[model samples]
Target chain A: MKPGTDWKNSYRANVFEEIPCGIVVIDRNLRIVDQNLAFTNIFGDGRGQTCYEVTRGRHTPCAECLAEQTFRDGQRRSREAMGVDPAGKPVHHLVQITPIRDETGNVPFVAALTTDLSATKRLQREYQTLFEKVPCYVTVVNRDYRVVKANTLFRKVFGEPTGEHCYQLFKRRHERCPECPAEQTFLDGGSHTSSHVGITRDGTAAHYVVSTAPLVQTDGETTHVIEMALDVTRLHRLEAELLRANALREALVENSPYAILILDQRRRVVLANRAAEKLWDCDRSTLIGHTLPRRAIACRLDEIVGRNGGPAPLVDSTIVTAKGVEIPVRLSGFTLHPVEGERSTAIIAQDLREIRTLEREKLDAERLAAVGQTVAGLAHGIKNILTGLEGGMYVTSGGLARHDEARVKQGWEMLERNIGRVSALVKNLLAFSRGDEPKPRLVRPAAIVADVVSLFKELAEQHDLVLETEISDVAPASMDAEGIHTCLTNLISNAFDACLVSHKPMCRVLVTLREENEEIIFEVTDTGCGMDYEVKQKAFTSFFTTKGSGGTGLGLLLTRKIVQQHGGSVTFESSSNEGTTFRLRFPRRRLPPPVEEEHNGS
Target chain B: MSREPSLHAPRVAIIDDEEDVLTFVRIALEDAGFTVEALDRPTEALATLEAFRPHVILLDLLMPEQMGVSLYTELRASPVLRDVPVIIVSGLNARDTLQEASAATGAGPPAGYLEKPVDAAALLDAVRRALSHSGRGTP
Candidate 1:
């Protein structure tokens, strides 16, 4: 043999074991294959083993064995096969087999070579599983809007894809969705997201949020787009419902009749309603996001939050409008639901100024009617006095014409008595009708009663009436001292007159002054001819008089007016032919607060 | 004798709650040559209506227990006193009271309407006209 020819034989014998490929030699009996080092590393120790058993971990030769065909035809071929390594891990291999020739040009041995492809196969499987198993719907669309790949989730919800168009599968249409984000991505080579509404294979509506990203080729040419979508129909419906509820709440707050305010926990106004605007005389733009200007509103808000989650009760206060008109209001506060993740407070206020004005009008109407009735009563008394005057003058002139001394004296006395009555009537009328506000001050009841009784004692003596006083000393109370004195005097004199007209064996009048139940009571009781039911009904009413022309019927009226001016009251209890008592009560704490005149343009 | 009838004394009945008004009217009527009877209580005046047999009645509108309108109703309802001439004497404006009384009584104005604080001459004149209008006496 030639020397160069012998080198090929030497190279095979020495270099076959280091070839990196798993090289094995098998005879026609498929036994005793020699494998290189790389084969041993992957399959482990294949010397003297059957070729089928060593390469494929099989008991016999494979049914379509490449080595058998190579041996018959002396051809080389490659294919893939799977087996397990010694460690029981799966191994995928690409096997190529060739024939080795004998000296007569006959093949005696076949060579089988294998490359391990297990890692590449594992990556492919992993990708497939990921595509099918993810929770969101995923798909791949070609430039023609065809669904080239669809995940299991997409298939489950929409239907198994059959090379149909993306628009046809998702929207049951031949055309694409308007302003398709996928189309925009293709044009710009950028990613885009959009919300889409479509119908499923089941003909049910579906809402989805889809994102498209460019899938580029090696030359940076975009041929297809990959889409990832989420089925957001349920989430979208819930959002819509929440928006509707928010709108309803806004409408209710805006239209409420009561002045409504929504404040943050920090007491800043977050919302003010129309009524609140009108009540404060400010618009919503000025009111919101600002602390209320009025102290009354601030105080009420503090009361509510300061209590820590409880509602505030109604409170009466005066609020000044933006126009600086002072108006009365009744306000209440309550905890409102969290607004925009913030703790909030709600306030409701009634514009009591309208109610106050209405009440004042009603009182004015009643007072006017009372004045009208009083004028009528005064006229009746005056008319009766006029008749007395005319009679007295006539009798006096007649007595003078007759020149009778005793008759002249009698007529003159009548004239004098009538004149005195007219003066007293005028004084009582003035006191009753006067609108001067009583200036309240502290006074002692016992001392005032003693002083009043002393002045009337002489008159009582002349009338042959007994005036007795039972006064108990007490602490000074708040009242108008002059008005109380006047009321007491009028009552005492009335009682004296009552005693004189009673025709009882003993004409007695009792006066008492004391304090009980936080009230100072001045009582004047008389044993006199008491009144009947009709007199009782019309007692304090106007134009009613039991004393005929001798009384103007205004003395008791004036007494009552004075008592009321002192934040007190006058009441009488009378029984016919038995007695009558008038009680004047002055409550200490009942004095009205001093009126402060409100000014505008502040 | 066909002489002036004003010389004869006529009976006058005055009912009023005001003692001063009753006293004044009684004296004036007596001085004007008329016999007078005064009652303060309207309820008592009802009892004396037949016994007193007055030629002219002076009725006051406002009184305790009964109003002047109610009293007039009572008098008109009575057969014995229905024919007597009534003169409404009121402290209220005489014309207004007469209008109201006339409407309530379903009659024309009374024989005479006298508003109080009246001049002495007006009193005698009203009574005289009331008496003559009743065909009971001449003034």
Candidate 2:
């Protein structure tokens, strides 16, 4: 071999065999002249063969061949082609063919450069599948707002939105959106997000959150906007429903008749109903989130705490009003444990003043009825006795007319006795009828008993009877002290009179004061000539006196009437010649105030 | 010719269940120079009214068995005694019953109704007024 020729061949072999891309040199007849190792590896080593046969395994020249085009036009040409290799695998190639001349101005050869695009084509197919199958709607639009490409969901949502203005398909508007995110993305080449309500081609409305990004080409030019829209109509509906429910609950609580107050774990007032506002006589807005005032009416805060802390059992208390009026109330509190954090207490307050007033009225009416009945019966009996006295007087007057000294003196004496009897009866009646009104005051039961014992001491001594008292130091009770004094005096007098009739003539009257269930009890017990069944039955009945000539029989009846007015009751136990015990019990609960004015003009 | 002198005084009968009231009225009528016959028993006094033929009859209300209103009703039912003027004296608080009874009775309800306990002068005046109205001479 010649030295220059050897060097030229060695350089050609090294250059042709080592190139990374597939290279082929075709002659003017469109035959393969030279090829690299990569080209043979890709096209299966066909030597001196037609270019179409070597690359495509076809016997004839390839249709629309770049080399042929380049040879004819003497200009570089490039085209995309699909070819088959020796293994029957399909390959995509981008081929560039250029004419080469040997300084003679005549085209001698075509150098064809082929770039395999199979990997790039496969990637594009995968991207198309992802775009078609994604759940969210995806679309591509040009800068002019015209849809360039759309996925299946995008087409289904906007009905083949391609080639149409993106705003027309997504917003069903004739014009572009004023602040479209896609337009912003195209301008800035950045991603943007927006939420808006859109109408579909079928006129169905939907809420959507759309994200848009600029699609930048390899030349760094943003030619399209890629948008992804997510539907959020259901979430919007849920938020609306929650708001409605909250409004309804607020309305119900505000209008409730019961005084309702909601307090946080820290005992601060969080919410209060209109009733609570009215009850406290404070503005509702001012009460919210404020610590409960110490001077809450109806009951002291400490007393309520003593009853039970929230959630408290139903309890009764007296609440003081802003005006310092104490009112009876029932307070109940319960804890509300919501799904979220801290527990709160809901307190309900019910006013009890009206019910208490009604109870008092009923008791007053019953006492009036019982007293009226007794008065009527007493008046009837007194009238009968008066008639007897008058009858005796008539006989005495007739006797006096006979002019016998003995008869005259006897008649005078008899008239004197009957007159005295009638006078005593009138006195007793007057005493009972007077002082029906109660003058209530705080008094100790023991003190009243002591006073009665002292007042009756002389009478007891004269009658040879023993009168003693046992007093308790329990809390004082409110009552009509004068009325109770009268009651005790009458009982002691009766006991002294009874002792005079007993065999031993020994009278023992015991007055005791005790406390039971927070009630003040006064017991008057006597051991002297106890009454029989018949007398006991008529003991409290007016004008049924057992003391033949002296007794007026209004004492026990009046005693019971006064005791009943003080929210108390009187009961007795008696046995023939053994003993008689009268007990009066007064409750510690305060009496209700008078409902009606004491005096009426009518 | 000398007329036979009247031997007995004309009698005025007073009926009441109350003895003190009866004695008081008897004294007043006697002092007024009229014979007074007071009876405690309504039934007995009614018999005396039939026998004695009192110029005026005073009736007390609210008596046992026969009330003043009922007694007045019985008297008016009799043709002979119905014309005799009757007065109702009552101690009851209700004057309506007395007025109603007087209006219902045909005999003009005792020339004057008196309430107990009747004063002496008032009782005398009532008796005189009743007798004078009946055209009867005082005893």
Candidate 3:
């Protein structure tokens, strides 16, 4: 119960014979006077021998003996010491020495008590290794911002900073960093963070993010700061590069000529370029954050860009103008790389109004040229008719003077017929020059062909030429009957002329009418002099004619226009000296409605 | 205005492409007491001319196979037919045709030029003038 008195009295009574720790009695010369069982177990019963020589297995007094100091000053002292155990293995212990003084107050013997501290010291060494080996630079600084202590990492990276300020060692700077986190930590005794630029011991640049924590005293006095820094140079470089690339990409997208729209994965407009703003006639601020209106986009956009018909822009598409009119456009789309969280799409649109205008102007010019050519041909044709009239009148007057009734009747008939021809020529010329769209009505093409064939039959007498027709009975279909009549007349006349110029004795002109594949086909062929390549190439060109003054060259052009209005086409094949065949095709379902100007204005 | 067509009339060869024009003109000139031989082809007219030995020729300028200007040139080159008067009748603009014919034949147009629907008067006038100018039909 009485620990000090009982335990001490017993140890003194038994002359330190028994205890858990090693006990020894030493004199002023640091020699052991007495030994106990624990001391014998530790130092091997070193009695009447120097304590250092017994415990350390040394032959001389040990350096800095704690018992010598205790004996000289008549005091007790304790220290951590290293010595050998009974097996001669190194042992770590806490050794305490007390002066055992005589009645005259002079110390003669020093009793030493030792505790084994090998396990605790081993744990402390492990903790110190962990602190030094951690990858990041770690250091403790005093209130003066000087590096008070540095770990192995800090010393390796910044060089040994035994007494130098942290800023001086890390950055080679003479003054403290303006926004030092360590200074803040010392002021508030709280953790602070900062990013800094510094240099390494190898003289290479280093970027670091430092976190400073207060190393507070037990009484909460913040006299020092512990700084832990993470080298982040690579991470900073990567972040800066990403920012520059983003800026460059934004610049390119914003400056594109076509309407550029960046859309989020949800198909909402994330951004709109300047062109997009003008094309949509909306401010970028208004359009950017909104989903694009469906009508403002083309339906064929998807088919233009990707497989499986994903969304994009396209040609033959119409864009809704600011005036609410739909104008045709050529559109294109691009799929941008998936960035961050969403894949984006971009669209571009080019307006086609100028092209359409140019097309219309070209058509108008062609029509005007046709009119001019038709007028020239008209003058020549009328001149022929006038000559015929004059000859007829002379014959009839002479016959009348001679009182010859038969000759007079023949001449009168000739005059009447020429007048009829002039009227027909005028009618056809008027029809062609009007330049109105065809009016489709139900009519039989075979009838029109027969009618055209009957118009010119005098060729049999003058030339070795023959005309024939092979017509198939067909149902009445939508067509411009009068226009077809003109077309047939023109073709038949041309065929007859071809037959006339052919030296072949058996020259023939054949007209065919039939229905094939729900389309009506009218073909006129001549086994006469065929057109050459140059003629065929210029067949549809305005005012290109080989018939000299006899042809207006408007016939085929008018035929083509009328056929086109009825959603049909006129094509021909010809070879020099072989033959010629022209075919006009009219699809039954696609005939054009009457001309806009043809209806009564009233 | 007939000067006097003798019982043996001066021969006129007519070459034209149009049959109707040939028929009507032949009847008109024949009734006017001139011997007329009509050929519908200028290519055939040269053969007909050799047989008929016409003292005068009426040529339509725009005949196919051979133009009248060229036929006129051929007649002037021949010793037998050179003295025969050639008159040009065309339905084309007469002044331009005459100029073209003159330029092509390298002879000054023809002995006479007539634009068609040459009435009986114009046809007879041009034919008679051509005959008189060449001193071929001096009835």
DockQ of each: 0.38, 0.04, 0.20
- Report the poorest 10 consecutive residues by lDDT, candidate 3 chain B: B1-10
DockQ of predicted candidate 2 = 0.04
Cα distance off (Å), candidate 3, residue A185:
36
Residue A404 Cα positional deviation in candidate 3, in Å, after optimal superposition: 6.6
Worst window of 10 by summed lDDT in candidate 2 chain B: B1-10
Off by over 4 Å in 3: A1-343, A398-413, A430-522, A529-562, A575-578, A587-602, B2-139
Docking quality tier of model 2: incorrect
lDDT of 3 by residue, A1-602 (tens): 68889988877767556667888888888888877787787778778778888878888876777777777677788998898986889999999998888999999898899877888899989967866887888888998988888889888766777789888888889999999999888778889998999987788878999999987555777888889888898998889999999999888877877777777766788888887777778788877777767777756446546544465545568877455777677777767776566667777777677778998999999878766755655665666567667767877887798788997998897688678767766665676667786677777778888877777666554675677889999888777888888788778877777776667778888899999998999999998778765567767754444553345456787788788878989999887667889999988777665443446657
Worst 10 residues of 2 chain A by lDDT: A300-309
Give the runs in model 2 whose Cα sits over 4 Å from its true position. Answer: A1-21, A24-112, A202-205, A216-221, A251-261, A264-340, A348-602, B1-139
Give RMSD to native, each candidate. Answer: 11.9, 16.5, 13.8
| Candidate numbers, best DockQ first, in rank order | 1, 3, 2
TM-scores for chain B, listed for all candidates? 0.82, 0.81, 0.81
Interface RMSD of 1: 2.3
2 versus 3: better TM-score goes to = 3
